[model samples]
Target: MKVGVVLPVFNQEPQYIFECIQSLQNQTFRQFKLAIVIDGANAETVNAVYEASQVLTIPFQIINRTENQGIAYTLNEGFSYLTDCPYLTWVSSDNRHYPEFLQALVKTMDSTPKEIVLVYSLYHRINEEGINVSNSEEMHQFMTSLMRRPKEQIYSVCFLGASFLFRRQAFEKAGGYRNKFPIAQDHDFWMRILQHGDIYFLEKYLMEYRVNGKYSLTTLTPSEDLILESMRSSIDNRKTIQDIPKVSVLLTSYNQCKYIDHAIESVLNQTFTNFHLIAVDDGSTDGTQEIIYQKKDSRLIGLFLNHRGKAHALNAGLEFCLGEYVLELDGDDWLDPQTLDIMVREMDKQPPNVGLTYANRKLWNQVGEKLIEGPIIPGLNYGDKYDVLSNLQTHCPRLYRKSALKSIGGWKRFIDGQPAILDDFLMFLDLAEKYDFHWINGALYHQRRHEKNITLIQQEEISSEIQKIVHAKIKEWGNEYIPEFIFNEGSLVKVDLRPRGLS
Candidate 1:
């Protein structure tokens, strides 16, 4: 298939523009054309692209608009010149594609049915310091869900501008770009096309999205609230929920009926909506099952089984999870109304290597009074496996990547040649080695402490469970794992209980 790769450029660093073009030219698939739209970019950026194209011996066309038009106009202009090509793809002038980027996307689209109008793969990030990082699973999960959805709602979430490939026919039917919104023009175009057809996702890393560039959204749009408001508007205008991100909330509970409603309420109250509530009552003799059944929401998937353990309960819930992503919520804990929406947004922005985006959690008292006012840990960042291992000793509400969990065989059913518990820790450890972790640094999840909760107690057996999981993780990561870290004394730092509202 013939491919037309269009790049819309504003002013970009000379070196980055050159590197991006070089990466594209070296792509494994050679039957492609590069359409460079110098959308009023500086002479340095245009010259860089030309120099790289010549050195690589890759033929390219430079479409220079006399005036500085926005990316939307540039994209439309570029597509106008590419009417002859069968397949169309685009990337930001600052972004780089992997060698197999086009090959994987083309192969997936070609093999899939004709109904699929768009094909998008995963992507990573490179910081301004040139350090490479992976996007979170939260992003992958959202894209995966969009791929499965009916056309309408899919576009609202997965319309990432540069990292997508589409057929020329579908592109035209979608009516090209909306030049109105300078920032989210891609979002507008994707929404319009969802009226026409379906989308497909390939679970592969195909590109590197530069997050730390001076011209990136982080700089252009500095207000966090404004970014969120834009997201809210996008969700509000979506017409249907056919392909909404399916969430399987794996609630592992022993017997906390008093707090179950709070957790369930938090989920049911999410403005983003559309999810399955899988509350695995871990052999709860309390009225927890009754409370769940009384909810009467069709989305609630209630499973009642004998008391095996938390690990067993989670695994059972996993078996029942039809959603693209799973969040393990303890029966006594809860989340904010925008928890899923915010977390999913970050996930959509992350690359494939990031298996999860977990924010900090808050501690609440029995009466639902706020206690600790901050995250369990402060200032956590994504993309380091080592940090994940150290923090797994104490963390909560980490939304795990469904595929990564499956690849690790769904939480080790056993440990140390014996039946094991704390399977969640084991699962996190396994994933930490292969995939990176993104920490949101907010208290979206609310953890409660009371007499009925197992987490409230300090047991020797619990420590043993943690140690067993740590050793198992060591076996997997080998030298890559940290040495000389133990749970007992100074090996790990312990948190001191303090008055409410104080850190």
Candidate 2:
């Protein structure tokens, strides 16, 4: 069977296009054709791809469109030229694949059933300097966590895109990508295909996704209104799923009298209905307790106890949690209306091994002057402990399996030093070792960066002490049980993580 690699390019940097083509040229599995579609691309990018393909002696075809149609349109047009290929695989022009990518994917496809319409392998993101900047362990944990659900249940988990190899028929059935979603078009396509059949994940790194450079297509032109509307519409669509996995919303708060009402309102306003809100008061000295008491929603349950730190507070909240899935929301931070609904739906479609799911979170700074968008590292697969340890810059609100959290013994309390500093970080490390995880591409949570928060109060000293503890534990527990933790000059450490089931 033949494999056709479809790369859609438009207004990309020349250097990125060249590097992307070069990776394909060096592929160890050589029997494939490269279809390069330049969507309203400039002369420089079109010429660069053409030159690289010629120099590498690889069979390639280029399709240049007269109008600057978007990526979705360009890719649909690229598929029009496929010449009797048995399979169709897509790679972004700004991304590069490993030499053995095709060989591995073909092997997995041959072993799996034909009805499994989509196949995706693990992938990493590289900085402009070609340095690796993704967390494979976290990605593995995230993906496996989602995968653990049921073979057919993954439709509720996530929509696999880009680094995926798909049957041409499945691609066509999914309607060849919708034009309505200029920003989240890939997500829309995956959701459509998942409704038909199952998706498979090959637990191996197959591609190098370039990030952090000025020349990347990942950067979009500044259109504030469009961006917001796109985000809103995406959430709306994600919430319209039936038979979604049950979710438990975990809220941790202490003395948030002023903002407690707003936080509660956020949870109550969620569009996804099959969820319970578990709030731990954590010994609030302020009137936060009264506000929670006054509220009367069956889904909202409050645990009012003396100060036991954030870790214990979460553990307390978990006791009251009855949902099959769990989401930890800081009392000070609120989620968009469809956050739980969308994420839970994504988690439901994953296989039984995928234990946790997370999504990018938008930032609402306390100043309220400007809203900041988080980095896009969702759907990034981190399958190793060392890689997870190194990619510390990317983090956001996440969801977890209730059983998976319990399997890790809830959150760990520092036996020796400051408990507040690296507690959440430490908890994530332990939970990651036992369960698989993945990140939803959408921003579901709205994080508020307030000066008075516990994270800011004890982050430096506490994180410093926790790093020493977690690093030492990794050595003590063996690499598999302890995800890799690397320390920098700052107390913050990068975690390298892998799927727990891997050897």
Candidate 3:
């Protein structure tokens, strides 16, 4: 039941060292052991550590090494001696834990289901002078946002902050800290260990992470190459496939050569591999078809058709879909690796009548050559026929039952004889009429907005088309389908509707 803590020290300031050790000494829960690993310390640092170790009343050990190995090596060396402790965690020299840090983490780990092998808590970001830099409320909101992501996404997002505890078994299974990604060792380790078991997030702030500019490893930025290599390795290692796909993704594009490859790769690299990608190119004269043919994944099926609009291209892709659920992805957009896994799992939990499930989306503006992140468009929890018709951009990463989609005659050119610019919206309206819609909370879809985007190029035309469709649908469904408007003063404020006849 004892917790093992490793404090890895390089050339940190003596005052910080004393304060860190004092934090441990004053812990509310005392059934813990500390290992102070001094990695090639200078004479002053070694003496300072010796002086700081005097105040510790608990059982502790100091491991001194002559060579200046990095954090990963030092961590491995320190944990090697704490084999008797069931729970293990490591702390940085510049950080200080709250008195209840060890107590709360141990309690949570003890109470958590056996499937969860690790637990992490929120932490306060402090300046060099120990002044809190981040607002408490803001930090809580930020951490809560990260907590919404499923563990399947750990490879892409690292929500495990400074304060964390893991079972020794998980540590052993992960093979300890890796030396490969020296700067991103913790993130790499988290990705590897997550494969073995789930991680629990404790919402309390339990530690003060000191941002001591040059003295802290947190300030060091890992090279983008290193990050990409680490992510690629982690993703490749975690790839799992099912013999039968549960979902089929239809990625349709037209002259999107610049972004098509990334979109295809995003679908192929998804953590949930039980889906096939049907990438349809609608006569791209800009080499988009060439990139689609170049990809060699067995799960990918490439189709090059004559110049047709998106609706036609989607219907073409639909002809090859072999999954129970279908998702349509724009070629200029990509997805989070965990999108399929999370959406499929969520959809499976709903009733058969819930034919559609979608998640939030991240907006990106692709100017000339740069891509800039915009605000996240949160998905509506429940969308009725009214919401679908009113909101132009409803939800994304929309995973729908293939049977339901087929029953409604798939995608259609709802506008003139030509393809409809609001094809997705039209599809949504058709699906909304026959089935219910559910929403998941994470920003799983990456929507890129550029000059070449259809929605942007034909905004006025799309608006006019949407209005015509809405009026026609309202007329067809009669008074029950027409929305009742609530007016404030002289302006209209809200529209209320009770749609209850389709079931």
Candidate 4:
């Protein structure tokens, strides 16, 4: 089982290039070849590649070009040269592969079905000197379980940056990478090949992805909107509903005229375009109804109601849903752009027992300008029945299975004198008996905190509602509920209400 590895370097340091070559040379599985392509690298890098090829014992193929054609063209040249190898993958110049990287990928591909085009393993991000700079250690178990189901739709970049061994046939079938996506060429290629065949995730650490600390901690394409639009085009032209929507996004607003536009735009610009959006105006006297009618998008289903409370408005939106999953967003708050897509994909990978998955979120100051703090679930595993009963965790930004939600009788109708948004908590309590919940690590929602917010009621009233809800659920579900934060604890939770910060 021989494989081809393409190393595309551009303006990278010679030492980093050597580190890459040495890492490949040290692989446990030896049946592989390195196709080194230098795209506008400095003199030192070109010299180093040439020098390393002479000393390396593995099969070496170097394509050093004189002019600086972008990474897309350089990678294509390397891909064209790999016609002799059956398996394919590429790595950045600054990253290094583990000894078992090739072995793990080959071993998995050999055991799996032939239709699996690529098998990408978990990778860590390292800085210039190759020091680990992230919490990748914690995600090992969490992500391993998440990737078992391969039918999910991907919104943003989730695969190992450049750490997969792909089938050569699939590459040709997908027409290779597109040059128009300067930085997102690989992601574009991934999207294309995913349509051709399934992708397998190997749960081993295969490589280290280098990050440009000078620019950003991550390597997402700067032109993400362009990539999203290109992906949308592919969906738009699909012959069948296989790639069509399986999720519905609901945003209910009463008088959020000032903030409603941004909320609507966020949903409209999602990378995963399959889901339908229903924005209910809840009979706002303000210009919120006008704003809802302004979008004129086919995916958007705007409905106007007569000053109904949030519970009534949300149920109205749910009535028109055609998708299997539902994403709940607030009228005053906006999503992280990728929230709907990522959550829907994550939910797709879940088992029958797992009915919902929520992600971490960012809390913003009044007017939603400054990012005051970033918040994550207390732990990755805090979604069980007992965990939910505990007053420690608050759940929001939830993506739910439409069937499960409907089976549970949809949103709990809010009665007067109830804590604001307590209906959501009641809905979750009932769902907890029959379904499971999972948490994703990334913070993708922006929660606005201000005087006019719905959940900003008095602390004593909130505490009373939460205490009543938790104890009632405990009795109903036969689970012990004990909270960590006791009397005099700060950071604002319901005095009696069951709510989390910024949810």
Candidate whose lDDT is highest: 3
Count of steric clashes across candidates, in order: 7, 49, 0, 16
- How do all models score by TM-score? 0.48, 0.49, 0.52, 0.51
- Model 2: per-residue lDDT, tens digit, 1-503? 37887888877677777888888888887778878887777788777877867756667788877578887887787777774676788787778888888888877877888788878876776888778877667766754543434433322223243477777877877778767867656656666676667777777778887875665545553433233333333333444544323787888888888777888889888888877676778878888976875565545555667777888888766765667888888888888888877888888898877877778777665755454554433435667434444454335567888888888788776556546555665666665566666768887777777778666677676556655755565565674544555566655655655546777
Q: Which candidate gets the maximum TM-score versus the true structure?
A: 3
lDDT of 4 by residue, 277-334 (tens): 8787787888997677645455666667776588888887787666788888888778
Model 2: per-residue Cα lDDT at residue 230: 39
lDDT tens readout by residue for model 1, 1-503: 28887888888888888878888878998878777888777788777867766756555788876589888888888877778878898888678888999888888889988888888766766787556765567766644443444444432243343567888888898788866555666666676665677777676678888886987755676443233333333443342434334676777677777778888888888876757677777767878866764564545556666777777778777765656677778888888788888877787788887787688777766645544443354436634555555555545667777887777777676776766655666776678777888778777888777665554464665666665565555556553343444454523433222223443
Instruction: Please give the CA lDDT of all the candidate structures.
Output: 0.69, 0.69, 0.80, 0.71
Q: Give candidate 3's TM-score.
A: 0.52
- The runs of at least 3 residues in candidate 3 whose Cα sits more than 4 Å from the true structure, single-residue gaps closed, are 222-226, 229-233, 239-503
Return the candidate ranking by TM-score, descending: 3, 4, 2, 1
lDDT for 191 in candidate 2 is: 65
Assess the local accuracy of residue 495 in candidate 4 as a C-alpha lDDT between 0 and 100: 28
